[model samples]
Target: MELLLKPIIEKPNETGSGHIKAAAPVRWALASLSLSMLMPSLSTSIANIALPTLAQAFGASFQQVQWIVLAYLLAITTLIVSVGKLGDIFGRRRLLLIGISLFTLASLFCGIAPTLSLLLAARGLQGLGAAMMMALTVAMVGGTVPKERTGSAMGLLGTMSAIGTTLGPSLGGILIAGFGWETIFLVNVPLGIANLLLAAHFLPADRPNAKTMQGRPDAIGTLLLALTLAAYALAMTMGRGSFGAVNIGLLLATAFGAALFLLAQAKVKSPLLRLSMFRDSTLTAGLAMSTLVSTVMMATLVVGPFYLSSALGFDAAEVGAIMSAGPLVAALMGVPAGRIVDRFGTHRMTITGLVGMIAGLFLLSAMQGRFGAAGYIGPIAIVTANYALFQAANNTMIMTDIQPEQRGVISGMLNLSRNLGLITGASVMGAVFTFASGVADITAAHAEAVAAGMQITFIIAALLIVATLGVALAGLAFARRASLLEEVS
Candidate 1:
């Protein structure tokens, strides 16, 4: 820790433009930020792998233990924007330190909790901490790295997220086998400590923005938005596979809550989200594309395992190995994707990435079953790599010129769109797969049925990508028109 801290503690010398020029300090700063990004995703995936073990340990049912994951996800989703607004008001650095501290402590609490309820509570608290980190990390990039390299920074963070997600299952399995389930939560403690230290020492101190600091944050708007998101998330998630009366009730509540939230935002002294930000075609389109792309990507996770094991007759270990390829491809491609964005420019790269994804999805949807695992892996790899590129470019496009005062909230919205996508994809794509397979029970489905489901799911996923590509083109057209009008004026 000392060795790592010594070089940076002296204070990184900044260029005249105020960005960090020293590669070593810049690397360390990114390392701290990378860990911040890693912890939440790691915590999520690691806990997922341990759910069965936890259910047995606590003598609980699958539904009850599932809350352990849902609670964390809900907390992050509902509170992410609110926390981002708070960071914009308070100070990103200060709030980030508090968040890291809270996350680390929560991990410890989760590790030691004797009751399932206590663990779930701690997990929720951990999610709150994660909300602050996820919202602020990208927002801080402008302050940390040179503006030109923002895409690279975004890519590196994406890589860390992939690494954390990819590493979790395998690591959790080993930790559970060697030291039991508690160790999975406990393992975060030391890494969190390291992350906290590096972040506190290296990340840029927040410069107070007088514009954003003028008034107190909108408490009423915040509550309404949070409640609305929670309702929507529950509506999508609670039904498992079946959307019954409860799901319909929740959806109604979500719609009603959203109306109230929008009205409240317009009237509030300071709003959780400025309704006017949506006027920016780029931001609006970027958020839409993000949500759409994320929803499509979730199809891979929701459908991959069942297809591999049932259709291909792969064992659990083989299924796990095949599934790991997506994240592995993401990790490997992240930096290169970012570099490509830097060289080619964000708008062009964003389109190129989407195009690549469309091509990959077409292959997945139409490939001959006789080709087997190689066919699946090849197309999925193409999708994953393009996703990395799209994410970096799209993030770079939206984040590059955002007002400093609005950065935190904008970043939060970006993440919120992705989370909502994942949730929607899990529910929607799963339903589609089940409906297409012609089986009431997916587990008992025949191999040909499973293969048909996989192909049908990918076809829908490809269509979604095509729709996202249209969004990208529309955004570009909007930008050009706006520029022309500005010049005329």
Candidate 2:
């Protein structure tokens, strides 16, 4: 390792404090990883905007059209961790290469599908491939970048994702207008092929490491984890439309599956997820806070369109345009915010972000009655910027200084928390809005009632954020005390 790094870096005597610049290869790896990450995220967002066009193309019903998106989401969310574990076992690079190949092939199938069913099947295949790529992209980025600059590297990756997600709707509209819905999926083909060639040429070979799992992957644990995620995600997705006994049963089954998964991991010789890793209090705290932040931020996204269109009487097109501002701001600020995290540390940036989110939520709540969606663009921008900084920093805070081998599972855990948070945030915020509006029929709700409900929803969101802030502060204190004790010892 030292030999590989030596040629690319200045000597410690020459550079001040043993600082090493990342090699050309490392920079290439980061760029490659970022582009790889961007495509999957962009694909999802683009697909969302193309759904109406697809429905018309296939003459599909609302439920069937919805499945086109849900199938991909479900497949990706459920399989992310499992594939991450596989990366640790076989090799991330190998898994990544395979994933890109599969994704490229799946996109081809999606583009030429003769029927809606085939398209949905192709989408699911595409999601499976995306899951593998997403699972390892961050880990690979961390592996190659200089340790001191991990936050900055991650920030760059986040920026790519932010841009991809935020750019999706407008890009999709343009493609669908000038070309067709098929163009969206087909657009990925060339990009995927180019990325594949880049990966094949640039990325270093993955070799056996001390950190790779030695024995067979945990079959029972894998099954249980899949079940738990599937049940939970499905329950959350289904709950929005129907909150009946089946949904309740699914929720119960999710809990049951989770318990079994925990038990299975404990007993397994080589567990898919290493439960022991949580022994690090920092990792636990970061994951918990990540879950909370994801819940609030994503839930805010869930409500934004409804608030804009239903309450503020903005057109759908206008709502989409305004909503893009937040993510665009996030994309713009991501690298700078990450540099700050590298300079100061995760705790300070996270606290700053938490405070910003609370302020943004309060501002949104206060201004909704007066300025409505017209006044929302700036506040949401602030909120997303806070999220960008917090995510870029806090994500690395737990795994940043850890052993390289542990990265696969840790990265997977991070992804899992974010996905789980999105589901939780959307569900909780939806329930709060429903209760506050006192309207069983969302489509029929009065504009005044929706406006009132949105305000209450923001207030509730702010309160939840406050609780997360408290826990994060406590965790920060704990880490400081531990550092002091280590110094004394």
Candidate 3:
């Protein structure tokens, strides 16, 4: 047992405290962390591509098979923060191991499930595992690598996430066409096993933190927050682009649940989310900018397809090929973006990224069909590359010096904000495109109408970038003022 659990050779961690810095161990640790980030993101997109196949296999309706995806999404959205808090209370290493095991087992179950209900159940379980992985991976980064290289680590994780998301559709398609839909789920088995072993071997041992041990888990706060997030996710997703009574009711429930959750947090002896954390202007600004930037990014995803297909008369394959550039650019830029952040600082790089996004979006807003695919791809690449830099900078800025015990929950909150933005963008931006097109049915909108809609939608998206830029600049100014005051005192 001692041999099996032997600690890796140690070196200085991000805090200048001792952890693993040996090249081999650090790379292995990074590999495990990268896999943790990849699996959840891959799961998010992979299932969408397999829905049709799953429906046929199970003799299910579109709505029924949709649960395979929705169940996973809802579980992650609702439970991510709660699981993060749990990791802090228990031990991140232990909980992360359990998460990997659950995800692996759930994948096996999902692959072989004979019934739709059974598949959905396994998918929900998989989502629970994903929530744990997504929440803790970033939190674990500070403990895994050197402090000066944190940005690079963040960028690597970002790159892995982009790879997972971008690879999913193509991978799922290949697996389904060659083997079957089952292979899509089954594929995770090998990767999950690899991740588990590497993580078990390479991750730092969880230390005994007296502060964390003394704190009680906030059960009421957890329940209320989960319910609130579930409501919000449902409200954004349920209508499939149209808002109805159910959507309205869910939104109302979200608002109510949020209020109750906030009240509960205030009253709880140990809150799931500490309200005081928001007092840090940097943290608050970072979270706000992340949400805003994510929302704008989603605009590209939602509107790009329609504009390419309807306005430009591109075929499905062409539209897909062109759209792939954004994620491809993001994936390629992640590491370089981190290096830039490391070299120039998060504040400067963040401002640079936002400025680049504004320029891309403004160009997109003025786009005309005469310029063809090159016009669209050019701006998207610029936006995406800069977005990679911005995300790396923002994440590093937020996660850099946070309290160790609070790391898990803070990471979860950052992810949650980004998720909320994506959900909002999918619905709201799509609506804006449709409304600007002056058409009830966007799918069949005329070329000129579609082009007009794309322009207007991007104009709105550019405004969002401008708002995010404001937050970044204001945060910088505030930080400078505070630093000056500290020096004067």
Candidate 4:
């Protein structure tokens, strides 16, 4: 609270553009936050490349080894809401420092674990840390930076994620090839420690939130939420392995668990999830748009690579190379996109982004015309660049409306929406491809079927983008109308 009490930059001007002050402290702040965010984002994608290596090392099937990835995701989704509340009550700086420490320790364990189960457990710890960092980093920056520059700050964070994810596969391959699988986890230790130090030195300290500091966390609500998110995530992640009793049971459990969480939230004294946050229609709209952007981007990552590998008989290396285009361009476009959002407003920029993304998807869908990997690059890059434009704007929209004290929770909610979108995209895209291709197994499917399936997936994603555009436009109109009514009254 004291740290926030003395903000580095004051409230932005009327237009909400962040003032560019002396570049030293602000630059360090931005770079530290960006790199800190990058570590967790990289971890998300890097492990996917290591799955085969892990399976072989552990003498496990593909299905069994998936827990490594799912475990991390499960941990984040379940604990993020509570962690956000903790940051608000205790202090974000304290939470983030502790989070980085936990993450580093877990990474060490992951490097040395002798068994698959232990590694999976360590990964869960890593996710817990990642969730804390993810929840607080945006809020910390939002509070520290001039309000007008908030969009640019988010753009920088987004750039970190884009770079992390984009470079992860390549980085994993090099590390695994050069040193072994252990190096992948080991690398995080020094980096995490260095980041922890930088954050400690540069990141502002936290002040206790009067609103939540004294209240006890809602135990029942927390448990119910954990069960709800864990079950839902597990079901989505493992659905491809076939709908067995465990998976089916999890789904059923998810339904009940969600109902219970809702009930618990309603009854709880100090809730983990503040349902009242949705009262801000602008924030609600921003959340929706964020989810849609995440879904479309993730689905593109999924089906785009699959199309190259399955339909065109490309190797993993070639597919990776082709798929890299999107994030590469996205990284380049992030800052400019953020500035555009600050200037033209999130509404105009979102619509622009959506239209560009839709056009790119259309081009990608037509890849059935014997296009090579190079052909795919253009469309992917275009769409990816638009992603930068869209997400930066959407993030600014969400953060701008949130109260400073509530930023921690709302930031968590923002990340949660994006994470859910990713889960949905991966699961739904796979299912749709399976059904459209009429293949029980993806690897065994004929080229024609796979191609058709990829086309259909892209089409579906494009349609969602269109729907997202409509929602943004409508929400903005409704917000404007409400403002007019209030003013008239």
Candidate 5:
């Protein structure tokens, strides 16, 4: 894989085009890429704040309303890896511009969507655009920045994403209350256009390697991955509502599709996933930790809103405000955590982060129903801070250890792991809510039951963090062993 893609890095040299000469252009490039990256996170949460309004507008159930959110996520999660590889093959700039254009169009459609089905379709389109932006952003940064500064660049980018996540719900709530639910989608229009313009002007072209660009995309691999991911997403989205014949079929198809995809990948000459990348212990450990982190994060996001609106009787605006706290802390702490990774190394920071995360989850788990807003605030803040640290540290560890040539693929894999974890987390938590509430209904009583389920889920999440801490410890021990072995040799 490295050999195949080596020409991409070498081509700029051959063309006498050194690293991007002007600082202004580089900064603009970074800003555009970062903004594009911010869209999906913002879109995801903005809609959360508008869910109740959307439910009313479309006369939809909670389960049906969730599709508005899940549609985009499912599309992006399924396509990110495939699109990232395509960017590596074709051109990152080209893909990015196309993505931004599609995103903008989708946003417009979303704003005007008159029916639930139409809105969901638009959201899925938006996810396709998001996938392109996400796949290219990190790869573009890797291509543009000096090797020494890449970590810092990545850190800043991560911080921006955290900020977007923080802002989305708050902004969404305000827009929904003042203008209506449609304004959330409308909000993306100006930002998307600006990003598109800036990217065209400032971003460098992806000079593809001859070997990699020679062949078309692996069709069989692509189909298998798509089928697998779609099946899994269906099983997740439909599992809670009506587990009838169709749902059962979807779940069974998901199992078969996943199996076939893995088998197909192994046989393909240039596999989409490049399963061998897991050979690196650092990558393996990081991926495992990442999966756990994402699962917890997703569950908390999905469950928190339910808890706030149903359990605590908070309005959409209040729920958005409360939910915003964690991302706010995460945004603040992301850069510092990256700096810590630069100084202290990933292992120590990861272990510390796990400890903090476990502590936070435990605090959340222990919250009593009688506790007021003040009681909830402190624990939620702790959880957010710890999560931010873990995210920054984990990203640094994963990217730093890999070969530069593999950055795009690794980025895709990392994202895939996180998204898959999120999907799984939502499913698991949804199941808990379903079982605990004893029906698909969302009522005050059901809300309390949901809270109980969340409490149990948080405990399980905390245990996962404990398990991750053990993995971190094991990694440290292995590092020591490698060091000793090198010295003796």
Candidate 6:
């Protein structure tokens, strides 16, 4: 067991604190991560605001407009893991620059796209670029930062992510209303260019080991994984009832691909995904928590606009304002949450955050139709706080457990899990909304059915939160027991 773990556990020598420079490398990496994190949230919110306009411009149906959002997410989800692995096999910094360039180019294409199909394709490519940036940013952090200060640095990174999430919708709304839909993508152009230049100047070059450099990428495994993710994403997007023969086939293919991928990984000399990493209990639990939290968080993103707009009669700007509330709280809470995690350990923070999240969800579920816009203030605030604490805590926990060498793969996988969770939540909530609203017209029933559906979804999300709390408690207990055993020995 020790021999098996030895290769996995060995990490690069920590950079000396005194030698660590505050100049270009750290700044560029941080900048890149911040911008990359901003893209998804920005795109999601911007598109939410632009959906009506897009429909008017293209004569698109509601369902087709939904694709404008789903297409980008699917692209990110599909390519993230592969891109992350490539970062490891190739060079993290090199890939980061390439990703940024691709992202900028994609943004340009999206801004000028003539047709709906072209726009969707451009968005997909943009997602691919975003994935590359996301996949490498943290790994780059691990590589560049001194071990002693890594936690603080990551906290800062989390803060940037929180800010991005907060600003995405609000800024997007402003841009769309003031200029046009093109401004949304155009916004990324300058930011992406800045990130690219910074990355080129500051990010460290990845020096691959002889073995890694010589090793071939697992082409078969990559295809299988892509197939699996694509199928699963498609199934979720299509919804359960809407799934026809093709969707069913895709689901089956996903299962087959996943099975084959795992089998191949077990046999391959150099696997793309290191299955051995799952042997660590902390890593496993951290990944699980990340997935659950992301699912719950994404449910809010999917359902919040509908609840605000349809239920409360909020327009695009109003919806953006209401939606921005959570991310703002998240941004405020991120740094404190990270500091707390460092001092008190991840388990307590995770438990507390999960509990807060459950409370928030329950509050949301209890919203009355008669209640005005102000009535939702409490629920939204609580949800935002929960999001802040949960994200910071979960990230701290996961990164603490993994060795530096494995950071790229682990970070990539964690991100992939989060993306998958987001897609799942969006799809499930979409289905729920459709079913609930179909039974009651918005005019006749006045969002009661939609509220009911949202309540059920929130309840399910709350249950997941409870499950996370249970895991956190168990982990704490295990840690206590291990400490006692160590003392006794």
In the predicted model 3, the residue pairs found to clash are: none
TM-score on alpha carbons, each prediction: 0.95, 0.94, 0.95, 0.93, 0.86, 0.86
Show the lowest summed lDDT stretch of 10 residues, model 4: 1-10
Q: Residue-wise lDDT of candidate 2 within 1-489, one digit each (tens)?
A: 233223323325454776445455565566678777888889889998888888899998777888888888888888888888888778888889899999989999999999999999999999999888787888786666657777777777788888889878889899999999988889989988888887887787776465566777788888898888998888888856447898889999998999999988888788887888887878998889889888888767877888888888889788888888888998887777777888888889889889998898888888885765557887788788888988888886866877766666677788888888988887777888877888996668888888888889888888878888897899999999999999999
Q: Which pairs clash in model 6?
A: none
Query: Candidate 3, 456: how far from true, in Å?
Result: 0.4
Model 6 RMSD vs true structure: 6.4
Per-residue lDDT of 452 in model 1:
95
lDDT of 4 by residue, 151-228 (tens): 777777887888898888899999999999998888889988888887887777778888876679778887888888
- Model 1 agreement with the true structure over 1-489: per-residue lDDT tens digits: 233223322333454344344666667788888899989999999999999999999999999999999999999999999998888988998899999999999999999999999999999999999999999998888888777778877887788899899999999999999999999999989989998888888888987678887878798988998899999899899968779999999999999999999999898777788899999999999999999999999999999999998888889998899899999999888777887887899999999999999999999877727577787888999999999999999999999999998999999999999999999999999999999999988889999999999999999999999999999999999999999999999
Clashes within 3 Å, all models in order:
0, 0, 0, 6, 0, 0
Question: 488, model 4: CA deviation in Å?
Answer: 1.7
Stretches of candidate 4 exceeding 4 Å from the true structure: 1-22, 241-245
**57-157 per-residue lDDT for model 3 (tens digits):** 89989988998998998999899898988888888888899999999999999999989999999999999999999999998998987777888888888
TM-score of 1: 0.95
**Candidate 6 Cα deviation (angstroms), residue 320:** 3.4
Q: Which residue runs does candidate 3 get wrong by more than 4 Å?
A: 1-21
Off by over 4 Å in 1: 1-21
lDDT of 6 by residue, 1-489 (tens): 122112222334566333323534455555556666666556665676688888988999888877888788787788788887787777777888888899899999999999999999998898888788777777776666555444445555666676766676667767878898898888889988887876787666776555555568878888788778988998877743365788788788888889999999999988888798777777777778778777778778777777777767789778777677777777766656656666676667778878888898888888745466666767877877766676767776777656555666777888888888877777665566556666533335456666676677777778888887887777777778888999999
**lDDT, candidate 5, 1-489, per-residue tens:** 122112212224446766434555666777787787688778877787688889999999988998888889888888888888887777778888999999999999999998999999999999999888877787777677655455455666677788788788678877888998889999999999999899999898767656666556788888888778888777766756446787778889988888888898788777777778776778888888888888887768767777777777789768767777777877777666666666676677778888998998899889835576655677877877777777767777777656544666677777888888887777776566556555556454565676776677778878888988888888778878988999999
- lDDT per prediction? 0.90, 0.82, 0.89, 0.82, 0.77, 0.73
